[model samples]
Target: MGFDQYHEPPEELSQKVRTFARMITSLIEEAEAIGWYEQRISVEKDPQARAIMKNAQGEEFKHFGMDLEFLLRQKQDWRAELKEILFTTGDIVKAGERGEKKVD
Candidate 1:
């Protein structure tokens, strides 16, 4: 069969797609946590912490970009969910640090 005939994936292939989506979601969560940790380190007055944070941020960014590229290639609708999770995590971290615990 050609491309069109193979377009409708079977149930097993669908499961694989879901698994890939979940994997990307996990990577996004990890990247978000690393980003937040890097931010916290950057606020430190010590030069060593600042340097560590800079390196951490770079690594996290690379991971984030890779995950995004994979998600885009998969053409899944979970992209918004991943974005929301990262944004929510960042907001929560910021709010808790301020003792406000507010989210938007």
Candidate 2:
């Protein structure tokens, strides 16, 4: 019920920008949920509760991935940068540097 996501006047922004902002908010919420579940699972001693938390955490992961894919599809440079850094087997910093080069 809060319009905290919009730093500027929402009426002045394009529909596409609004949609992007909403997705970014969703992505952040999903990430926070995932982290919360992780912490809960770590402290939870009950096996059933832990299992349920893990399952919910996995669902959050899926949502996060979907949001990321949607955002990446909207930006070719983001896709290229992620492609260079993600799923690779070398140093991550080096891969990020490579990704930056791709963006540059």
Candidate 3:
């Protein structure tokens, strides 16, 4: 089976790298599912159907968080940088700049 997630030759990459790539792909897929659900929910007129889509979207959000946490655990520097950038209010650009400096 072809793994489209790998940019490099799979044979040359470490097992850990392969797993990371898989999780990254999973994260992307979950984000896409969330966006698709958002669009569907926005257009749907039925309240029941919209509620179901919202529930499904919540699951996707959870999956995305799990995938991200896994990837973050694998990369400490990334975790440190994100700590500075995520879950904070005011001046997102400043937070990112601070994160960049911390990582650097």
Candidate 4:
């Protein structure tokens, strides 16, 4: 089966690289699912159905976080950069600038 995630020849890519690509794809899918759930929850008339959608959205958020953490573990520079930006309260643009400098 052809995997669309790889821009290069899959046979030439390392196993680690292939795993990274799969995880990245998974992350994107999870994020998209979260957005879809958000829209559904917003318009849902049934309270129980909305609650279920919210719960599912929460799971997607967890999946996205896990995938991001895994990817970060593979790249120290990325982890370092995000450390300067994540979970901090301040100007987002400035935080991003700091993160860029850290990676630089």
Reference-based TM-score of each model? 0.49, 0.96, 0.96, 0.97
Compose the digit string of candidate 2's lDDT tens values, residues 4-59: 99999999999999999999999999999999999999999999999999999999
- Cα lDDT, model 1, residue 53: 77
Root mean square deviation (Cα) for candidate 1: 11.1
For residues 45-86, write the lDDT of model 1, one tens digit per residue: 988878887787778777777777676567534453344444
Q: Name the best candidate (by TM-score).
A: 4
TM-score of 2: 0.96
Rank candidates, TM-score, best first.
4, 3, 2, 1
Residues 1-104, candidate 3: write the lDDT tens digits.
Answer: 98899889999999999999999999999999999999999999999999999999999999999999999999999999999989999899999999989989
RMSD in Å for all candidates? 11.1, 1.0, 0.8, 0.7
Residue pairs with backbone overlap in model 1: none
Could you tell me the lDDT of residue 82 within candidate 2? 91
In terms of lDDT, model 1 sits at 0.62
**Candidate No. with top lDDT:** 3
The Cα error of candidate 4 at residue 28, in Å, is 0.4
lDDT of 4 at 82: 91
Poorest 10 consecutive residues of model 3 by lDDT? Answer: 1-10
- Alpha-carbon deviation at 72 in model 1, angstroms: 0.9
RMSD of 2: 1.0
Over the stretch 1-104, how does candidate 4's per-residue lDDT look in tens digits? 88899999999999999999999999999999999999999999999999999999999999999999999999999999899899999998899999999889
Model 4, CA-based lDDT: 0.95
